[model samples]
Target: AQSVTQPDARVTVSEGASLQLRCKYSYSGTPYLFWYVQYPRQGLQLLLKYYSGDPVVQGVNGFEAEFIKSNSSFHLRKASVHWSDSAVYFCAVTGATGGNNKLTFGQGTVLSVIP
Candidate 1:
């Protein structure tokens, strides 16, 4: 079975500061990883995904994630953050099988960006 975990339940950073949200997975085989962000009243939006090829993948709004196979981790990072970036970020994992792509999500890490 595949599972995802976001160690930090909440993260705070000043505006324009760099950010990194930690994510770890438990899966024997290679699994599809995703980072999704949910704004105040909106649905979850895809930040970035890692299917194959490169270890690092770029996402929207200058967000990026690196897939480290050995560590079984896929951590999200950004060079700088804005106040708008403050939201709930979720780390999800799904196995590449069957038609139904069911994603297992972490508890979610709430980001707070101070001005």
Candidate 2:
């Protein structure tokens, strides 16, 4: 079985500050990891993804994440955040069964950026 865990239920940050969100996963085989962001009343947009190769993956809006195989972690980071960045972030993983690419999402971390 494949699953994801997001420790933080919500995170608040001031505008122009940096941010980081934690994520962990458990899977039987090689997993495909991804981060998605959703704004108010909108669908989720892909932030970044990691299938293979580099451990670090860059995302839009100055977001990035580093994949740690040993720790089974893929944490998201941003150097500077804007007020528009305030939204909900979800960490997801896909199994290697080679069937439907259904994503298992975490509980989600709500980011509140204060101006």
Candidate 3:
């Protein structure tokens, strides 16, 4: 079975500070990895995605993630964060089986930024 685990349920960081969110996944072969951000009462927006090719992938809003095959991890990083960046982060995975592209999400990590 394929699954993802986010070690931190919540992360609090001050404005203009660096941030890194951890994510680990369990899968057999090459899987589609994605990082999504959800704001208050809004739908999820894709931060980044790793299907193949490059191990490190960049996303919107200055977010980047590196896909580590050996460790089965895809951790998100940002050099600086802002108060507006405060939201929930979720790590997701999808396979090639098709049909709706059902994504299995992590429990979610709520990020709180203090201005």
* Segments of candidate 3 deviating more than 4 angstroms: 97-100
TM-score of each: 0.96, 0.96, 0.94
TM-score, cand. 2 vs. native: 0.96
- Model 1 per-residue lDDT tens digits across residues 1-115: 7788999999999999999999999976669999999999999999999999899999999999999999999999999999999999999998866536889999999999999
Q: Which stretches of candidate 2 lie over 4 Å from their true place?
A: none
Q: Model 2 over residues 10-48: C-alpha lDDT tens digits?
A: 999999999999999998789899999999999999999
How many clashes does the backbone of model 1 have?
0
The global Cα lDDT (0 to 1) of model 2 is 0.95
What order do candidates take by lDDT, descending? Answer: 2, 1, 3
2 or 3, which is superior by TM-score?
A: 2
Single out the weakest 10-residue window by summed lDDT for candidate 1.
93-102
Residue 19 local lDDT, model 2:
95
Cα lDDT of all candidates, in order?
0.94, 0.95, 0.92
lDDT at position 41, candidate 2: 97
